[model samples]
Target: MAVALSRRTVAKNALSQLGTFALSGGSKAIAAIMVARTLGPKGMGTFSLSWTLAGTLAFVAVLGLDNRLIRELARTRDPRELERSLPLACLLGLIFGGLLTGIPALTGVHSDAAQALAAAGGFVAVSAPILIFRATFHAREKMEYETVTCVVEGAVALIAVAVALGAGFGVGGAMLGLTAGRVANLILCLVLYRRLWGPVRIEIAARRWLGLIHEGWPLAVSYSLTATFLRFDILVLAIFHPSAEVGMYGAASVILLTAPLVAVSFSSSLYPILAQAEGLDDEHLQSVFQKTSRILIVAALPLATGLTVLATPIAEMLFGSDFGHTGRYLALLAWILPFRFVNHLFGVVLAATHRARSRRLAAVALALIANLALNLMLIPTWGAYGAVAATIATELVIAGLLLAGIRPLRPILARPLVEGALVALAMTGVVLVTPGGIFPQLATGGASFAGGLWVLFLWLPSRGLAAFSATEQESAAAA
Candidate 1:
């Protein structure tokens, strides 16, 4: 029964986080479209490159301490130790992040782009501490706090970007707006955190912080590699192509990534719960892991199908005629959703087992290197389409590696995957024939896959509760 409560908490938090991601994604789309349209492809390309660089450097600033703290907090309820370590994490982040984030922006790039990126990098430095604070809420499975903060951040950023562009600030102005939004996010997080745990009396805590860094370094490396894997293509494309082409690619990439963001939010909601079980109770962890994998796989199918089918229309509608070929890139990149979703799930499972550091470090390193190499190889010749191909190929290889590594999940995943594929195939058929416009096609495809899955997984086990609840309980009992 206690376990059941935890399971419900995870579900509830997952939903909240889903909403957060939706809001964030919507805001990102609006910002990108406006910025890209205003600045043209070349200008947009520069902004995107700087933004990607900031993100990559932000991960470097964290050194993976957030995950370690969250896992530690989830496994226990000791506030004193964590309280001491968190401030240390934030201070360290600020120290490293300030130097790393500012140096390149001031020295590495040109004038307008440099100023914009430097500000954004400063935002990342401010934002890294927020990750540590937010993880406290996450450990307790109280995602609404994080959700609210994201909403505020996104809302501020959207308004700022719109206002900046309207004022003729262009991409650089929009970047500044983004920085302002992060400042808002940081303040909000600190206030909320203060309420949750009172004032932060952070006294060095050298040994503990160092220990966390040692433990978390693997995840931090994994994170940087993964982000680079996704963002590298655009940087590569920018190098080989013009700004307009980069803008078009950016347009496609934004929409293509929304689904993966959902997957990541879902997995993050489950992280603390799974961390609680890890080596202590394999059965519960395995069962929940399997269930999560199935849901994501099923969800990914219709998403991939719909995007593949309607990419062109949606691209044109959202980005305008300026990005004519956006749909083509989207169609090619749509395959990444299903693969990325499953890959994210497996990555979570690995983290839960506490072997994520070494395992993921190696796998993600290979993936990052592979993505970079492919982008270099493909983008020069094929342009954006080649970049898309590189993305699809890189994710496929990573997914393959993840599958091979998680042998225990094979029997568990086989049936659900096949069922998901068949359902997706059927859904895709309906979408292909439905005609009408984007909405109709999307509605038909989504309904078909979801309705089908509901029927397939509707039966309850022994608890006599609903199927979903029963499954969770049964899985918990197995532990």
Candidate 2:
């Protein structure tokens, strides 16, 4: 009965995550379209660059302690210890946030509105506590609380941006609104976490603090470096290209990247389960990885295929005709989703399994080398497309290297690869027949996806797909 309840909990959590992503992703996409129209490419570019910088700084502020908190608190099952770690993590987050925000100001990059940037930085600095508190919820596996926090945060951010735009604040207004939303989220998360975790008794030990830092510092370094690689291209473009170009690239990237929400949702739902399962023997670990990989591939393939085949029409419908070229870039980027999805899953597995150091090293090295090479080779020729190419190349390298490092994960890779190819073929057939209109393209894509899923379901060994269905009592019993 407990096992049945646990399975149900996992399923419920997974569904909630999917719901949250659907809401958040839809809201964000709508917001991006509105912002793109309001600011054009240059304004969008500036916003994207600022966001990239802010996100990088946010990762720094986290110092990788978020995951540490989850692991330690989950393992220790000690609420008192978890409560104690919160303020310390927040302190570190503030210091890092201050440095991140201050560096740009001191360098005269924000020459026109240094005060506003500084204020923004301070707002971000205060955000660390919110982030740490949020991690505490994840540690306790309180998916409902986590989901509520995410949905509320996203909804607030979207509404705030719309209001800011309507009020004629433009890009800066949007950023301020975003910062405000984060602050709101931080406050809400703290209140909810306290209520959920019960009254907090704050205590700290130097040894415990150092232990978390020691475990998390490498992850922090890995996260920071990996973040740099992910966002460095935008920074490069901001330096070399016009803000309009940056905006164009940024807008298109946002649209293309939206597809990964499905993959991310799956990973987020499963990571805790995997973390708990880590104590099991090797055979059980491998079984979990295999089943998880199959589920991930099954979900990712059709989504990627649909995006690739319908990229142009989807882009136009979402962002308007003004963004036609951006649509083309989105199309090209669709191809990377399968690879990115695989990378995301394996990367989580690596981190959860304590191989994060090696994964981080490979990721950083690949990102640096790929960014330099791609920027030099493609940027002058392809502009934003060049950046996309660079991103794809870098992600592939990181995924490839990480897979090499974690040999145990290799056996699970075959099904996803095959499934992806089959879905691509089916999507190609649908695209060839579908006409130009938006509704027609969407219908065609939807039909293709449904048909492809049916075919794959019929063809793949039943054992592989069975693990995904929580209601299959017999299969559950077998597992």
Candidate 3:
């Protein structure tokens, strides 16, 4: 009965994650399209500047409390710990939100645009504290609560933005909607947390909070690096180019970055299991790491292929000709999908193993340094295209470094790396040959690739191209 309940809970959590992504991805797409269609490139760029900075600031304020709470609570849920975290988190969040709203000049946007950017940035900070509650639900594996809250947030943002646009509120209006949505999201999450974990309180103890901060500081550094990498290209581009160029980059980015959302969801679902498996034997742990790496690599191939093939039509359809360059940017950026997939698996492994913190941090830190230097070298000459180049290169190097840290992972990566590349190549060929609108193209491309890969693996066993296979049950057991 315990095992049965565990399996059922895992299934529910996976479904809940998928639902959350659907809500988040869909809302973001709606918001992006609306911004592109209404505000044009320059306007979108201004918004992105504010929004990105705000995210960075919020990360600063949260101090990695979300992950820390989840990790500790997953170990053992103590009411005293929960009570302490609630107030500490709120206090830190308020401080961070104030910093975000207080500083407008940091974005380098000028005049009226700068003002709009400041408002957006402030709102983003205001919304970030809700993650503490979300993490609590995650630790308990009651993702259904967070999923509902996410949907409510997205729905509220969309309605707010639509209403604001109709009323001619422009960039500032859309930002206000996002901020308002965050409030609603926080309220819902807080209510749910109370239902499951009880009411919030403030019983702060300096020593305890300090200890919590010490425990989470590494996470803070790690998350900041990760978040910065995601937005670094744009931040650098804004420095070297016009708002319109930044907008175009932002447009492609909104879609390109969504590729990792699915991978993240998968890794996130596996995280608790892996964390709990720390005491397992070496053979079992090795098996877990190897299988997870393979799964993510294989999953990334078709996605990267399909998205790359569809980039042009999707970009044009979504943003029109003013943003035609976004397609090429996306195509070039598509390869990062596989690299990012591998890196996420590495991250979960690192987090689970618990000894890889310094190594992981060093690898990402090096990647960031390299990313910035490359952007400086390339962005001036190539603009948005340069940013894409930096992105692909940085992720590739980061994944390679992390893989090197996990000595046992090389062999696992070796076979799938070749297989995934070959599969993606086959997928690319099919997509190129079967030319049509989105649906027909996707259908033909997907079928042909799936059929071709199926045949290749089956008939050419000597080629060592046997498909990596794992049932969900097998993967769960390995974890």
Which pairs of residues have clashing backbones in candidate 2?
41-244, 42-243, 42-244, 45-247
Candidate 3: worst-modelled 10 consecutive residues by lDDT: 1-10
Where in model 1 is the C-alpha error above 4 Å? 1-5, 91-110, 411-414, 429-436, 443-450, 457-479
lDDT of 1 by residue, 1-479 (tens): 02442667877988888877787666766788788777766676777776777666766677777787788877776566556666766676677656645765457755666666666666667767788888787777778888888899898998999999899877668877877777788889888877876776566667676777778888888887888888898888878888778878888888876767778888878787777654523677667777788878877776787788888888877777667788888988888898889888878777766754477678888888888889999999999888988999999989878776665665256766787778878898898899788888878877887777776666323325566687899999999
In order of appearance, the predictions have TM-scores of: 0.88, 0.85, 0.87
- Note the Cα lDDT for every prediction shown: 0.76, 0.69, 0.75
TM-score of 1: 0.88
By lDDT, highest first, what's the ranking? 1, 3, 2
- Evaluated at residue 245, the lDDT of candidate 1 is 89
The stretch of ten residues in a row with the least summed lDDT in candidate 2 is 111-120
Candidate 1 RMSD computed on C-alpha atoms after optimal superposition onto the true structure: 4.8
How many pairs collide in each candidate, listed in order? 3, 4, 0
Please give, for residues 1-479, the per-residue lDDT of candidate 3 as tens digits: 00122556656776788778778766766887898888889888877776677656666677877777777787777756666676777778777776655556566555645566556655656555687788888888888887899899899989998888779887777777777777788889878988988877657786799888888777778778888988888888988899999998898888876667767776677666566654323455566566667767876787787778788887878887788888988888888888898887777666655556667778778888888888889999999988988988899889888877766555366777677777778777777777576777778777866675565454666444333334555777889
How far is 3's C-alpha from truth in model 2 (Å)?
8.9
Per-residue error for 201 in candidate 1, Å, reads: 2.4
